[model samples]
Target: MTTPTSSTVLVPRIRGALAHSDRIVLPQSVLEQLLSEAGRESLPSPLTFRVFNPATNAYTHCGVREFSAPESTVLISPQIASTLGVSEKQLQASSTQDGSTPPVLLVSKCDLPKGTFVSLCPLDTNYLTMDDNWKALLESALQASYTTLTEGQTFSIVNPATREAITLLVNNLQPEKAVCIVETDLTVDITAMSEDHAWKSVAHRDAKRKVESGKVATISQDAPVRGTFSDLSQVFLFDLKSWDRSRPVIVELEVLDAGDSSERDIDGRAADVFVSIDEHPSKDYFLWSTQTDEKNVISIAPSNSFLATAEKITLAVRSCVVPLSFSLMVSQEEGIVEQKSAPAPQSESRQCPNCKQLFPPRTFQLHTAFCERNNLLCPHLGCGRIFRRQDGIPASHWHCDLDSFSCDSVSTKEKHILAHHTLATCVCGESFPSQQHLAHHRATICPQKLHICRFCHLRLPQESRDSQSDLLAGYTGHEFRCGTRTTDCPRCNRIVKLRDLDSHMQLHELQRVSAPLPRICANALCVRVIDDDPAAANSNSLGLCSSCFGPLYSPMHDPTGARLKGRIERRYFIQLTTGCKRSYCTNPACVTGRTNSNLPKLAPAEVAAMVKELTEGGKLEFCVDDGMTRRRRLVNWIGDDNEFARPWICRAVGEVRVGGEDDDPTSSEAKARSWLVENGVRITEVR
Candidate 1:
């Protein structure tokens, strides 16, 4: 066979995807040329190629990702470019005979050994601080981005959840310096780059914990902290570690001063400030977050799961402008009595009509002259604040023309208009007045919100409920339909709806736990449980099922039980004298079972004596039947101890139950022997 080979210019993949992978893209012309050179209809699957950078004198193996590059130009991933010491400088246009072109790498078809083991070392310890399940995430990232491995090469893996990137260097490889990772089971060992790196990682984690723990403010009952935020990003951490957590604490935030809004537009579009109480430093486990425009006295009871185990409560604030002042108080939920101040003594004064201010009667006229010229009353309805007329209302005091909201600052007015007047539409086609409303609508009530289906295990948009019944049933429309698909229950062998399967299986489990175990057939060789038939439950005396006790059953009555014992004796006599002579018989109590099992059979006189002795005890087992039911019992019993009995039982039950036409007495024994051979039921000698 001819080897396919080609030379092409390698350039770093600047724009498109697979930037972290080792796969490369080649020109379509190169692929066609390689195919023609090999004299084959198609190129081999997962085409492996060796790329050589002549300028750097370096080489690396790669897998083809696509054949859609520009003519004579190959697009190698950044990882591959780094591996071969190729840089973007080589991709710069050069003055050539055909205008401008730069190609500095050679590509050729080659075979590589499959990888068996690899050792990787992370460049830093940032990956150690990731979630505990990050190892699986790393493996997934590696699988998605790599097709080959080489020693001394470095690659980066990005976390999809947090978008954090960590670089790893290939430290060692087994079987070869480079190996094809396609369809190979590789043993991977991951370690920190060095011992010093591990120590630094630990130190970094401890330092972060110390900072967070030290920043938390402790609160006591009835005592509140007055806080001020200079900016929106300011966060206040508090802890109730010293207080009794058993009693619910009410965390209250009273806005003392909203600050000057006209200074600048608020950082957010909603409320001026948002307060939340969370357990985690990241606030991932928040108990409550401000959901409405309740800025006056926002009181939240920290009574959720976070309050039980949280060491610290993080009070995060997101706001529009700075210099915001608020009073944060934590008190017992039931004991908050408002304190009423004593009425202030009435002051003897005269009311000034111009600025609505009370002044001393002595200088009333003089005060009025200055107040009337310098101070001006607000012209807006319900707003009587007086400002200096010379400063032209200060430019900070403004009122909305459309609503009854009047506040200080032009930015606050703009924010109010945007929050209450501007309309926003969600992707689900619902419209809201503000972004905050839209966000809340999408998170809580949107039917198109993505949710994982419990039955189908697929992520899909939640479907609208068909009716109130569906809502009461706690199922989405998708779940209702998905649960309609039926599956056979292995325990009861009954078809049950997926939605009801849990309860049905639970019912079965309850029955199993509460009901008594079924009694085994009286026959020592039989493995069948005694059936609850009329003969087996009411009349049978040996605890045997109808099938096992049917032959000896009769309506004849004997006062002394002599006839019953005689029948049992006769059954044993027949087993010893004629012998069932079947190979599967393994009962140690029966003469036929012993004989077929390679044990010496008793003589006729000895058999008679043994039968008499057994019947004298008023109990005996019938084991001479060659019926299908009897054979099934034996098969089940053997299956418990022998792995090879399953196929034989399957074939034996199928043949006897489904196709029993050959039971013509003369051919019955021959058919049984033939079945033993076909089903591979070996007749082993008794030990």
Candidate 2:
């Protein structure tokens, strides 16, 4: 597929939609996509619509609707509105800022042939209530489709009666969300990550960049901006005020919290740093884009520098999806540098006698390491490789050619290298950066891009393109997935525009259930094309193969399918049918084992059964891994020999529970107190 541009799209997911109508309504964008795949050909008898949720890797089939679902919404009844006490009337009904009216809690009652049904009840009245501040936060979160807040984690809300955050945890926020509760142990902490990596608001930009009435005019120096994979939240806008338009500009980069450059360092840590300069008015257009390595200081020389441009530079970073970014604006007035100078160098100061400059606090440690004038000799004893303090400062990533200038301090040596290093020029008479940068220039953005995409009619300006055929590989693989592009044929010497390939080829990915192109059922023995073949979609097939249809794994139709499907008789046939389907579950005892892999593609119910057998029947050994919950067992599971499970788990309620729990812990109060003290928890009370 052609690279999808970075974007945040809001796709509405409706719950309780079936509560009001037989047909499922959806936004125009979603409907168009659905029609493109599922609703393509002739409408089937007793039409069905299937939707696959990639997040859960599951599909939902609904009864079809002939007319379009209008206005990017699913409307519930006014009575429902009264029931919910929420109205999206003020939310513009936009795809982004819309939400469900409210939530109705459900309880299960197992009193049917098929099984238990989860129906709403008056006693299941624990919905949600929030104050104005919380309401805004929740609204914003829902708009962004935040996983934690919208997924029914117990969010402590301000109690209207007591004005205190309540500790009531809510559950089952699916399809749509409109309820909340206080956080609990079961409430998954979606924000699980290391200190360096957490989804959080890190930095703030000058609001004036977009809105004139923006409160902040400049990026907060104190704040560190954070970005994501798609959004470059941190962009440092730098204005080149140099009078000479043709002259190149130098850009400096500083890594914050880039651990100690002193004795120990975190320089080896992997970081994806993007440094791109805005070249043209077109948003995605870029004049220059390159990445940096190492955490130490470095300066980049870039051409095509402009003056007073609204948007200029950007600094976005990523450690995969967890992204971080920071913005900076550089402005310099003519002769302004001379006016805002520091005090003259003093002999008593950390400033070396020869360098005649003051060191920023961050660099003082490194600067003092090799400054011979201040008598701070290299830590490497007897290696009298010293230089005038003048040759050191602003550690640059340059290496010295001379072997004599070997200072033990890395920063000091780096400075000397830059001072003594010579610039290399390209064949085009353009001065190139150091060797590595020159190599990178040769690879990407090398003015003379030869290999071109025949489809996109675009030049491949990346590294190392061998022959025309090698470049064609990229065009065919990367450029020609879905869109239209202009391609030039090498052998035929002909240029033609390519049409959108998705129009004809997208049926293979059809997820929704409706009438469309022919497709063989996933079953190996069953070669049924339910859409194209009329007989395939009949009641006999149940719109699926005999084996698949027999499973009838729709939770919508059967609420207690697990208990029903797990019966011994059903299990034998189900395994036999699935065994032929694939290498999943080939236990000869259950079904005719086929294929060597013998992978068990257990259905949800089957998994629950296996787990039950393992735990209850003691079919497997259990230690820390709980046989039932699969979670680490409680500390009482801890023995005198079990060092790992003996420690008290800090419960959110502030109760310390071991495997023995609160009461059993008093029996081993001495042991518990000793353990607590060893772990640095003050032993306030043992009994």
Candidate 3:
């Protein structure tokens, strides 16, 4: 909403001297100056107007108005007059309207500058109604006008022809209703308004003075003065323009002391007084007071309707300040200090078994069980005995002696009890009452089936189905031999079993190689001759054969017949000394002739050959001491030696005869000689 600018008017400027003290006082000149300034200034001219009717107490709208020289007037149109229920003759007949029915004038103007007086002159009397609606309208209008006047910008009107100016100073206006016109000189700018604005400060100062002097200062001529109702917690309704002190307009609220009875004052004194007010009906407003103060005040708006309904404003009073004497007395009666508890009793001391150190009685008991299980004994080695816990049992109860033969004599019943009554049964359909009985029966009483090797008499399981039986059976016959490729048995004319072949060869008698023969004896003394089995006449024979005088010479022998001679010697020794009737060499290297002679010589060739012959013939025998019989025999021999022979040997072997004294020394020699003569007739030899 832009403010409209009024039409400009023309005026003259006159400069003249006045008769009083050289001051410019020309009436016509001053009038001309005013007119010129007014002409240059564009003022607000009303587009519509209102006139108040006193008799009816209502506002009627009049027609549009424009600014005129020496007067601000409204041009009342016939339509406007008819609409307002008034005649144009009445409006034209009056230069100024009656106070009861004044007209509202509007002018088109920019926002006024600070301190500029801008009046809404000829205001309608209908605006004075105390009705709520009228009051609200009046308030709104006042606020709006005030806002317009206080706008920061300044406005000026100038006449283009004469260059005369009018600077408007209209930025001062109260926000409330204007009951009277105020006139003041332009002083300060509107843009710099503060809380202490000039008009408000003056008002506050004037109000304060009025209050101190016991006079009721009204905020406005039409509103009532607000009075404090601290006498009690009550509400008050006030007219801001009048200074009327009337009865409260709202419901009375109960007042009560709010402070605690035992609370202390700032100086550490007991409190006996307090102040309080009841909860207000409107939660936005409340009453409050300090404990030290005995009065209460209710918070309410001057214009609130409920304030007028209060019957009385009563301030509940109680002593809030505490007495110092009362505080000291209470302290004396209650006793201010606290008491502490006494310490607990200490336990007695005792010795620890593990470390042999003293410890508290309770500690020893707690650790003794653990110490006993670990076998800690007294530190003194001479007495290194384990400490028994103090249970009421004899030392024998836990004896560890193992020398007693009692364990051997424990009965079968005891054994059964110890073995948890477990019984044993044999595969042969025999059963025993306990494990001990079963063990004894299996070891001694049971008829165990046995398989014996015919040659070695070694026991074997009856269930064995291997060729061991055949091997054993073959060994008992004269014609049997192991089928192994080499080392055949001479007497039986068969190969020995694989395992016995090497040992059997070591005992062969016939021309057997004593030490393995060299391939061709590097010593040039050994002879090589392979045996031909006469029993194998069906097979090819290339090597030499045995004869009475020498080897039956094979065509394959050495041309010089040296090997034949060696063969004859070997055969002779084997037959004559070994008493072997067989004719085959059983040595492995002799059969293959791959031996090295650097190794040590073995047993004599004749003995080896005889042994071999006996073994092959199934006639070899040995005497092995049976473990039970030999042990018994050894025990008897040892006992006899210890009883008789050892004593005799000890006496006879170490005894020494000492010679007699001088007189009998020659006699001793003569006796020795006599003894030699008696025993062997060697008396001359001794001489």
Candidate 4:
């Protein structure tokens, strides 16, 4: 086996000969064309080959095949060609018949599957040399297709001869996964003089050991440690389990300059230091100045250790000092010492010349001058004392010493003569020579009196007399007096005095009565009597008496005429009977009863007219003597009376014919009454 020499493969022009088709066949001519194209291009070893089928608009997989140099016609394996649906002849013919040249076929290149081999092809050629440009074009086309495919995509290849296209599809394409990397640094510092100095270093070493041991290290404080720093720093923290560094926590410190005051006081000085740490980075540190001024001397615990630590840690302290200077002088000659003796004590007491009160000598003398100017005398009235003047003793300063009145002359003492005896009389006529006596008189000697009214038992000042009559007039002769003095007696018709009227009426056997009881008239008119009757008090016509029954059947007045006394209560009854004959109540309780001897006799003409109307079915009646029968008739009339008759009468007369063909010469009584009313007879006053 000799090594084949390299030669360029030429790419054939793809034209109408291999136009796209919906049902593509991989002919042996097409396979040979691919192999020839690969050899002529002198493509690199392990090159990719692809083929597209217009028939499914998809690429199909073909196995890798080795290329052997320039003029050799490449042949595809029978298995691969069969898988590709091509014949051996077609594969061989795809290469050149000329010894130095390569055969070609124009065919759609979309037949290969993604990442699968289709056919061997050269990487170099006229077209292949322009791979950069073509690659860009292909990428743009692929991007466009991919974008379209991603957005409701459908793909197809056009068959030039049939003018039809086949479709291809891919559901989804996996994207490339990403990996990210981040870096950080952390820094740390240690101050050996801090109280946790050894612990801090141990913690740091332990943390490192933990990292090496693949155990996670957490910086939880056993006790919080406070410290100070002068510059900015960075801190690092590491995750020992992962051995990964976290981002650096940066801390910045502010610089402070102490002025020229040199007394450094460190009492109660404090600060806070922040430290940050991260894995894969350094640690950062910062200082905060929290120091406070020392106000007073304060003793701190474990002073020696604290001072030593403070000195080593460069802590600021204030210095305070008080400076002093001294000088001394000495006299020449004898170096001597001196001694002295004690003085004797003196008595100190004096009495005031005025009151004889004892006091210290110095105080007494000082008070004496003031006492003399203000005339301070003894308050004892019996002594009648007066203070003596500094110049001459006054006579009033002498006091009486004798027991008898005539011999009780004032006597002089060493201080002064007692004078001006107190008087026994007080302004209020009480005697008191002293305030104590006067107070006793006021308490036991004053008099007071109060006066009261005798009648009403009301209290009043002794000086007021105006209320006497009002208090005296409350008595009444009777237990209850009558309230009516202006009203007349119903029986005697006399006005009774309010106070004596009840007793005066009792003399006449008249109890102070209310108005006499009301009674219905026994007359035919049945009038009601509201006035009191002395006669009815003794007699009975069912308590109505004789006067009301006398005028029953009188022709002088209409028997049915409404008596004024009765109509007072029967106005509406009268109005209902406007055109009808007046009604007569013949009940024995009425004045028109049969027993009334003064009943007036009616005329024969009147009796005949009433009898005619009564027989003609009109409402007319005459008083009769039958008591029970008359009562029954009165009750029936009251029951049967239609109070709606007046309006009926008005309607009948309103249709009456006057001087007309249908006129009646005989007028009805209603028409006569209407004529009378029209001729100025007052209907309301008719009696």
Say which candidate scores most in lDDT: 1
Q: Rank the candidates by lDDT, best first.
A: 1, 2, 3, 4
lDDT of 3 by residue, 504-618 (tens): 6556522232223212111111121222224323222222212222233456747676665455445434433433222222222232111222323334674467445643453
Which sections of candidate 3 miss by over 4 Å? 1-687
> Best by TM-score, which number?
1
Name the Cα RMSD for model 4.
54.6
Q: Model 1 off-target regions past 4 Å?
A: 1-4, 9-14, 26-48, 66-73, 92-98, 108-136, 159-166, 173-176, 179-232, 236-252, 255-292, 296-315, 319-527, 530-687
Of the candidates numbered 1 and 3, which has the greater TM-score value? 1
Q: Compared to the true structure, candidate 4 yields what TM-score?
A: 0.12
Cα error of candidate 4 at position 139, Å:
99
Superior candidate under lDDT, 2 versus 3: 2
Q: How well does candidate 1 match the true structure, expressed as C-alpha RMSD?
A: 14.6
| Full-model lDDT for every candidate | 0.63, 0.33, 0.30, 0.30
List model 1 lDDT by residue over 134-203, tens digit each: 6665665666578788788888877543446788999999999888887788888887678898788779
- Each model's TM-score? 0.48, 0.21, 0.13, 0.12
Q: After superposition, which runs of candidate 4 have C-alpha atoms over 4 Å from their true positions?
A: 1-516, 522-527, 530-548, 551-687
lDDT of 1 at 53: 77
Model 2 quality (TM-score): 0.21
